[model samples]
Target: MSRAIRRNSLTEQATDALLDYIAERQLGEGDSLPPTGELAATFEVSVPVIREAIAALSGIGLLRRQQGRESVVAAPGATHLSRLLTLRVAHAAVEDDAIQQYREVVEVGSARLAASNRSEESLRELDDALADLRAVADDESLHAADIAFHAALARASGNDLFVLTIDALQPLLHRLRRRVWSGWVNSGGDLTSIVEAHATILERVRERDADGAARAMTDHLAQARLGLDVLSGHVGDSPARD
Candidate 1:
């Protein structure tokens, strides 16, 4: 019996104990957890309390529960982070520039890695995303294609962590991309140049030129910064357009 010593709230204590149980047993994705009754008995809590703890864990993607089946450890995902960011943006809890800066760090590094690690399949995905981006006339579809391009680049980096972070950022990036692109259009900016920027990055990555890929990504981000500045009234027309 894995006894849960009460430290704070009973539910919290039970949750902690449950986590300990999982770690102790080295449970992994698809690994079934012991029954609720067994957990309740071990934690010295009522079955309802144990269920509450399980629910809390499940909410965060730590466990998957189903009717008539034992709860299993879940495969990790960005779903919780994605939802949290979407909600934060909804409530204005985070700034767009902050999000953009964080993206600069993650994506620049991803572009660099992708140049060295990309496969034929990832290159094909990037080509498809770029084609969609070039073809889209509407804001919604353009933003979707832009995100697909970035997400595919992140995947090409051959890093699971990068893929997860970019996946978590997709919803937020879609809104930001729409805002930036719309602002640029409203300011008489050429959307063709925007597509060309992505094309340059892909060209460098496809050539396996790591430093060139990083520089292309950096330039792309600089252009986005100009768009953001124009949107925020920090600049009147992007100087890059001059």
Candidate 2:
């Protein structure tokens, strides 16, 4: 047995220790969690507390329950966060526009860093993602491709924190992307223009022009925001989202 957890904070302390255990072992997605009994012994906490900690981690998408009997580490993604963001936006505690603007600011910086630090493999990934974007004809596929392209750039920035931060925002991004893209398609907007915007950013990344990449991304998002506004009937006079 190890240090006994205080009764009042047992679950929280065990949760932190569990996270540390995973990190110390460098556990990745799909890795089996050590048994709860073992964890209880390690933390000198009751099995109930260990279970509580597991439940909390699972709720955050850090862990997954398999067959309702086993727990596994989950792959890093925005799966659970999307719901939380959607609900928060629905409740009006946070404005959707603010979230979109935040993404623009963060992505602009990420694009600049990507231009400077992107590896050859990352460059290839960007190329592939863009290629996939160009091939998708439907709005849904296009939205997915768009998100993938941005995610690729985030990873290319060579900053894991940036990548994770952006990943967490994907749900909201996808929401806006889908709405704007579908509206554009319905309104007879040109898909080629959207592809070209991504291409411009990719070209700057390839040329290692950080300023150009950042500027291209800024312009792209500005256009997208305009389009989203039009879709929501807020820009009846200005047609945007090209």
Candidate 3:
């Protein structure tokens, strides 16, 4: 039996109740939700209230609605997460350093996983992205290739969540990278070492050397940290590239 929602905040309470119901029932992506009429009865609310609640859930990527079909559970992808993250950043709820640190943890783990689970197709994709990165000179071209390379690396991890998360964060990460690139250019640094770092990581993944891949990624991120600091307006001598 569903618990009755309080009347004080019908839509908000119904939304919370629906979320609890989904979790209690262990609903997975694509599981069809009960019809709005049925949900209204279950929550002891009016049908219109239930509709509004469903709309609220759909707004946050928790539900998918069809014109005449029942709504289904949704798998929050890059678009949804990016929207939420952008909102949080705009409100100053999250800072660039927090984003950078989170990426380092996820990406290092992704490198290790990719070394063990990467497929030939993913390897080829990474190689192509790296090739493009090596060849691109303009910031726009480099940004596109850089994003592709990171996305490919995360995809190679064979974890959908990692792929979703890194993809969502790429826009934020690009801002940091752009700052780093601008500083590097002004300081007369070349792209050779950056390309070399990625090559080493891909080679380690190809050899199935999980530990080596992890270490290489750690080193690469350490270099990126220098640029991220610069982005945060911490002026200092640029870190030397190998």
Give the top-scoring candidate (TM-score). 1
Highest lDDT among the candidates is held by which one? Answer: 1
Better of 1 and 2 by lDDT: 1
Rank order by TM-score, top first? 1, 3, 2
Each prediction's TM-score versus the true structure: 0.88, 0.71, 0.86
- Predicted candidate 2 versus true structure: per-residue lDDT over 154-209, tens digit per residue: 99999887787677778777877877776565666688988999999999999999
Residue 202 local lDDT, model 2: 95
TM-score (C-alpha, index-matched) for candidate 3: 0.86
Candidate 2, residue 180: how far the Cα is off, in Å: 2.1
- Per-structure clash totals for the candidates: 0, 1, 0
Residue 74 of model 2: what lDDT? 90
Off by over 4 Å in 1: 1-7, 89-92, 236-242
State residue 50's C-alpha deviation in candidate 2, in Å.
Answer: 3.1
Instruction: Write down the lDDT of every candidate, Cα atoms only.
Output: 0.88, 0.84, 0.86
Off by over 4 Å in 2: 1-10, 13-45, 61-77, 80-93, 182-189, 236-242
Q: Who is ahead in TM-score, 1 or 3?
A: 1
Worst 10 residues of 1 by lDDT: 233-242
